[model samples]
Target: MSQADNLIQRLFSRRAGSLLPLVLLGVLTGIIASLVMMSFLFLLNATLGGLNGKNLEDFEALTWHWQLGLPLAGSLLLILLYRLTPPACQSVGLAYVLERLQFGQGRIPAANIGFQFVAALIALGSGHSVGREGPTVHLGAGIASQIGQLSGRPPSQLRLLLGCGTAAAISAAFNTPLAGVLFAMEVVLMEYSLLGFAPIIAAAITASALTNGLLGTHAILEPVSLSLASYRELPGLLLTGLWVGLLAALFQRLVLVFIRLPLTSRAVRLLLAGAITGGLALVTPQILGSGYDTINLALSDGLPWPLLLGILAAKLLATAAAIGLGVPGGQIAPTLMLGVCAGSVAGALLPGASDPALYALLGMAAMMSAVLHAPLAAIATVLELSLSAEAMLPAMVVVLGANLLCQHGFHLPSLVITQLRVRGQELQTHPLRTALAQRYLSELADMSLVEWSGEGAPPRSKATALVVKRDQHYYLLNPAQLEQRMAPDTLDALLTPERRLQRLERDMSLLDALRTLQDDTGAGFLVPVRRGRGLVTRARLVHMLTEEGGLY
Candidate 1:
């Protein structure tokens, strides 16, 4: 690490203690994230539109042969891309981002970000039934993480940047700044406080403004003002929530099936996903791209019963197959498409006159909330889209109700959590472990330091402890031992070879440190010595966790 990185790491060890710098960094991160999203959307549109003199259209206008062959061709290109990329750098998307931020310190490699940029373009541009939001979210967070990694920030500050970038991405994609902030908190951080709120909010707002100004787009969806028809519709609303919850469960279950399949080869998985998408597109072309046109059509009451029913079955299966089989794309836009279709169908069947847009809105909130277990984010999305308080009442009822069914009735975890679990990274179920994993190692570093590694008489300092380096290892010497003449005379002898310590990187968290210590219970932590840098022992981690009400 550079000296500047070390300086920033040590400076922000106490999370959120520096609000000014955090907010400033949040703005910078948001700006970068917005430019990335603008480019992503432009490139995707230009590629899809360039085929037939259409300016910015999806694959809906494509020839039958192009629609049939694009997904398969995309898979072939991805196979070539994957073969050239290293296995370690192959991981992309939100789950991959969560793994890097939550498990290790928030040091996302730049190469993965680069791969996602190209990979998402191939997956979405080639008519895979996935969304652009996922790749954009990954891109935003990855860029912020790269900044943090370069600056040498601690995990806490780095985590803040990660959240900021996520918020910016979602904000830019959907033009919902509040939803973006909540998503960063509710989905990524999995915890929240005022310390996180300011920077996240700043990032979300900045990103939303930048994208809107640059792209001349605002409120991508023509969200209508909606309210309940009557008290009699309460039953219908309840049924709608329950129905949407069932769809959410089915969506997750389909992905789960593909995930658990015996097919082990990445090549087989990608090709099979491509083949399934191609087959489904033959049945209904609506599942070809991100399906934004379908979503708009549903909200406008344009889809007929047969078409709605067709999309209900085909899009669900196509998205499940694409995502479950490990396509490096996002599921958010697809989830919205599925929700709108399900909601429109539910509205048609319910025994009351209703606006199709209202049902579509409710369905969007319910499925998104239930599947991700993120009701607040869903509600915030509804409120922002509607720009009124009317959407909140029903949004809450259906959103929370569906979440209850998906979590309690179906006993399902969030989709993102499921994505992690399938890859053998279980949620840190223990509250304390999860808490510690969010904290940094520098918080427990020893503050007192009196280096005596020189050959002279230790420079005559009044420090209480003597620390020295020998053979690139740090040894904690006793000042009392020196006073009693029991210690070795020379600095070389003062550093004994008795017990070697593990080299702990300055970026690791307390949880990471503890895990390393667990490998050899006899070993302790020894940070590389720079100017005034001190060791962090195993006992420090224990003390941080077991102290007065820290665990409880």
Candidate 2:
């Protein structure tokens, strides 16, 4: 290896638990993730600049014929691309990232990233009613995963870097570092710890700083001050939460319906996805693209209730079909629009609220929280974008209400989870597994051990494990068991089915080890360590999680 490569590998191995290496890794990840995200944003803007200057998402400027043709052309192109591309590379999105993290040990192919770049650019620039955030997630996580794989990091650390990239992407996209961190934890990692927070926070800050420096200063959503008038508005806020939850559930259901449809032909699905988006754009041009313009209008009171309602319905259908069928764009932007429209309509129906804008903001939070099932991240996003500390209580109320209704009332999980489950990929984020994943199994392995000849047993078992080699593989046993295994015809029975542990070539995170541990309940995993083979047992893992709360 090159000198720097060797140095990095050495640092990674030596200080795997240190914060300094992680902080530096986070910064580097942020820089690359932000630069890549900006590249996509720049291309998207330049591509769409002809249709709408300064405002990238304004499909209203397009004539009806252009609006009708753009999405269809884009869809045709995507269909062609999908047909030619390998099936493994076609899966791209935040849900894909989650799936890889849980099942694939954070390994993402580079081809998928390339596919996402092209697909998302075409889908978003062509006014497909999808957002950029979903594409951003795919790009960011894919890039980070590739980097970790190249660096020769283990599964656990690779997972950490992947999350760092995800956080950086969001921070760069929105200039909301806190929201990015929260989103990474709540939606991406689905766990929180000091080990994760430090690097992720650093990555988010770096990403936000770089994007702000390069893209020039502008708000994704303008900061609007809002205040609650009286106790009377509380009921309406709760009702708005319920309304947004219903809308969120409907959006998910519509997407699922399109997904489950019997349109087996890829060409037909892509064609209809594009045709539906274009047809919606024909009547309500504002529904095209991410619909940021529509959101701004709702926040500014520019859209009348009837027009807003029409736009909302059209946008919902367009987004569900576009994203559900095959488009590679994001869901967050469209979700925000849905929330804003739903909130605005609710505000108009129920007077005595402070302003429709406040409701708009609340709707954004509630819809996001409910749809993504990320209440904390959604609340953080709105708070950071709006810069209204006073909105916290109401945002929380609406977010929690929406989440409860969407999850319990409708029996739905997060959209990403639902998608993966449909594809037979279960994202196991059990609290115990999550906790175990954070720890290095090698560190907890019994490293101090003695090797025993097949003929005899060791002297003692005090703070030292006993290992025996048979069939060129090492297995762990105590002195007494070693003696028992030396008897005639006893080795095969003991080694094969009774107390044999699987051997690992190197140290792995407890999460990966635990996954491999499910096959046999006899013993744990064995890894080659410095002195001798290090043994990691499943019982030890459970004990660590339940009893060693204060130890780490």
Candidate 3:
């Protein structure tokens, strides 16, 4: 083993009380997950070629192999996978990672991982209309969760480590380390902090190195040449962005609508989705296997105009059906395909048209941004994938625009919306922000009230109580009022039940505390901390909220 690997292994020796152990576990999990994915991918390729007698090119051929052969093969493969694996493994692969986050590390059973791997392989090999990223992501998370469980990490910490595994998988898959790290923070773990950054970055870099060692330097799409026409084209780029964003919105809606068809039999659904993909393949084979060949072909500017729209619609429908049928795969490939189509179509409409290949590259990034709601990652991905200035500059604008449209117009990315739906959370509002607030408040609610501060104090305070008062501009009690109210029965009156008593922590983030306070109608609530705690009067909390713009 290398020094880092050895170091990671040693840290896990004393599994308890150290973050080092979790980091080490993340690295190990990432490496193992990558290897497992590679093996599965290789087997899938071989099976498609050897067992099924279908090569990569066969995926694009207009034949019954995809229509009939794929459905038959996929149905049998799914049946075998379902029979061999547990019932819980049947959902889309990414669902497994989300389940782990909400439940616990041990929630993802080992059998589920094996099932997902096998099922994803079968689906991909059979030419089911799904992407690879989702399966790999789930595989990585399951592996990391297992590692964290073995090392005895807490659920919360393990969740973060799971994010690390997710980051590693993306980095390995796309060779985009920064995007993977950002995705880990933004999507998987849903938090951003120095503490969360370390393990994810380490795991991402480690997995990237390992993946590079195995696969060398080829990306999914070939690098294409791009040249800026002129500053005059900037306005046209903006128009392209608008079109890409709209296409992305349409894509998201289609996926959701199809996936919710409520087909009674999953087997039937798989066959149906396969049949649709096969028919599309019959028309144009370029839509198969991440559409790498078609994307490159489209990028060449030599592709006949007659086939562009048909291929675009076919790939879109195929991917949507593939995922809707509960197949295990990623959405990244489909997202890229959508972008290519959108950009190619948009570019064709422009005067003094640019290279279609350049547009294809831009479309991939723009569509990804819309689907993922991560403009930076999308832009970076295009830059890395194309290595062309023309693709990068326009791609950034397209991604930014698509992200804006998706967030404000459509509300949220499809994955986040799907996750919220699965959790039974309302999607019209910010459910995650509410969940975050609730989690924080729940933790605070469990603590004992230690002290009372802020606002008027009761005339009489108990022996254990620390009374605090706030005047117009100061926190000290009004001495004049205290003296004037100092009656023999003053202490007794202050001790009455009507008087308020609550404890609050000052260090709590205002965002969370405000939400907690809003949920209750009491004058105030008791908050506790390891150190000194104080009461935050209802008025003060309300004032804070008003100033902060509103409750979560």
Candidate 4:
């Protein structure tokens, strides 16, 4: 092998050696992702400002006719874009990224990235009730995937790179570094390790610093100082969690309903969704965009209860229609808006609440936690956004309550996981199974204990297994069983179809390897190490699982 090839092999031969390279790659990924996100935000804001003469989110400032016409035109444009693009290149957003990571080895097509950029620009700028974070995530992960492909990293390491990019994107989007790391762990990667944490944290910190330096902390919700009125408000916090959990469940169900609509034509769906959003916009322009401005108003208690309720209903319906119809925007912004409205309503109705702003902040965390099924990340996001230590206790209580209600009461999973299931990609959520899936087969392969030779006399040692090489194939044999059965002269006679061996790449996961074993009646699998092919037996796997605290 060439020296360069040898070095590449050494770097990624095991998971540990890949960490430094991943960390270095993560720095580059963060910078690139942050820059791309900044450019997208700038272009989107410029386009919206040029059209409406206000901030990108200030769709309410536009005239009634403009508010009604913008979404209709934008939706038609989206339909045209989809019609022009190939179906394979049309998938975008968090669900797409997760699907790719799970099955595509973190390889995102460049065409999809281009499509997402253009589609998101049209959807967000034209006053569609969606956030830009989803597109940003696609962009970041796509860039990282391209980098991994260029570097020729194995799929195992490439997945880590994808997580780094995802973290960077979230950090850049909100300038919440710690929240970004937690989100990547809880939502994107779905598994965590010290090795993975280092790179992801590096990526998030770098991305947050870079974006803050360039854009000066591009947070949508304005910071507010908040505190609980008293211990008496604890019950109110619990009720708020229950209320927001119900709202979150409703929102997720509505989005799923929209996603599973019977209409086969993409154009018809887009048009119908646009018409709904536009009709709603005519009634309440505050629902026309991401609704960040309205969220701010609700947070500061600037809007009355009636207006808050109206904005909440309109925004919820519009966002659900837009996303369900497959608009290329994010659900985060809409969820935040929903939380604000829910909390505002709670504060007005509940007597023990100290301030509406406090409830709004807690409700925001709770709704996000319940809908995304990411309590720690949601709590971190709220603490970072508010910069208030005093809000942590209330935030934790509300987030826990909301999560419990969603999981037990409604039997809801995270929105992304739900969408993935709808698309026929059921992810493994068991802790042991997920942990095993993250580990490579090479990690468990026992090379020193096995002897490799032809199908002849046994090796002069206490070897547990024997590998017989014939022609270009390798077969595994149990020494004790071989002694009981008597010597077989030819390899072909000994290795029957059921005893035939399967070849496993060094990067294939242990869980996947186990699954392969269950599906096929092979003697065992052969894993290629630097020295030679390593044999992994079913007995070995069972032992490992037992040691790891039983099968999942």
lDDT of each: 0.79, 0.81, 0.64, 0.81
**How do the predictions measure up, each by TM-score?**
0.88, 0.88, 0.74, 0.86
The window of 10 residues in a row where model 3 has the poorest summed lDDT is 470-479
Q: Once superposed on the true structure, which residue ranges of model 4 sit more than 4 Å away at CA?
A: 1-18, 438-489, 496-499, 503-509, 519-521, 526-552
Backbone clash tally (model 4): 0
lDDT of 1 by residue, 98-181 (tens): 887777667788999999999999998888889887787789899889877766566778887899999998898779999999
lDDT of 3 by residue, 1-552 (tens): 467555544566532235565566667766876677567667866876763354353565436554456645776778766766667656547755665565332246677777777777777777666677788778777778777655545445666778888888877777777878887776666567666677788888888888889978647666778865666777777777777888777776777777778787877777777677766776666666666556766776456655777777877888877776666777777778778777877777776556666666777888887877667667776776666765666777667777777778767655545645745753333655524432322222223222223324434433333344322111222233454334545543444322343344333444455565566444555455333444455565556445643322
- RMSD score of candidate 4 (Å): 4.6
Of the candidates numbered 2 and 4, which has the greater TM-score value? 2
Report the C-alpha lDDT of model 2 over 1-552, residue by residue, as the tens digit. Answer: 688777776765534466777778888889999999889878888998877887777778878998999999999889888988999999888888888887677889999999999999888888888888888888888878887776666567778888898999988888888988888888888888788899899899999999999887657787778867776888788988998999999999999998998988988998999899888888999888887777876777556778879988998999889877878888998999999888888888887848778888899999989989888899888888878888888888788778888999999988989888888877766887665655466556666666655665345666556666677756666655456325646755555544566777766767677666676655777776555667776677677656744224
Report the C-alpha displacement of residue 502, candidate 2, in angstroms.
Answer: 2.8
**Which of 1 and 3 is the better model by lDDT?**
1
Model 4, poorest ten-residue lDDT window? 483-492
Q: Is candidate 2 or candidate 3 better by TM-score?
A: 2
Candidate 1: misplaced stretches above 4 Å?
1-16, 52-58, 386-389, 429-431, 450-464, 467-481, 487-508, 512-524, 528-533, 537-552
lDDT of 4 at 95: 88
Order by TM-score, highest first: 2, 1, 4, 3
Off by over 4 Å in 2: 13-16, 436-474, 477-497, 503-521, 526-552
Arrange candidates, best lDDT first. Answer: 2, 4, 1, 3
Better of 3 and 4 by TM-score: 4
